[model samples]
Target: MDDQTRLELEAAAFRRLQKHLMEDRTDVQNIDMMNLAGFCRNCLGRWYQEAAAERGIEMSKDEGREAFYGMPYADWKANYQTDSTPEQQSAFKESFAKNVENQTP
Candidate 1:
């Protein structure tokens, strides 16, 4: 495939993933995703911010998050977030260390 086609395909896939996470699987907590997958909706938002930066678009973290979550981060938390257990927190710490720490945003 050509470059434009590849980019379009990738963007479509990302949109699908966002829909899956935001709409189809609202019950999946960010902490659990972080612990198991080493990334979550927040990470997707951060990446959106970074991508805007690459294109010289000034997007704040909150703006990126809103764009991804289809609402404010606080609202998403209120609507869908659950309290993490001690075990989940511990696993998140390890996962963050292994998967996120030292990575430049």
Candidate 2:
């Protein structure tokens, strides 16, 4: 496919994934996702913010999160976020350090 077509496809897939997480699968905890998948909704929002910066769009982290979640981060957390277990937190810290924090920029 052409470049534009490829970008469109990727954007569509991202939107679908966002919808799946933010709407369809709200029960999935971010900590569990970080532990198992090494990324979560916040990571996705950060990526969006980075992409905007790359293009000189000047987006903030909160703005990117609002774009991704279709609402403020606090609101989403209040409405959909569930409390994670101690085990999940421990695994998330390990997984995040290994999978994300240690990676080269």
Per-model TM-score, in order, reads 0.94, 0.92
| Per-residue lDDT of candidate 2, residues 23-94 (tens digit) | 899999888888888889998998888889989999999999998889999999999888888888889889
Among all candidates shown, the one with the greatest TM-score: 1
1-105 per-residue lDDT for model 1 (tens digits): 999999999999999999999999999999999988989999999899999999999999999999999999999999999889999999999998887896776
Per-model root-mean-square deviation over C-alphas? 1.0, 1.1
Query: What is the lDDT of every predicted structure here?
Result: 0.93, 0.89
Candidate achieving the largest lDDT? 1
How many clashing pairs does model 2 include? 0
- Point out where model 1 deviates above 4 Å: none
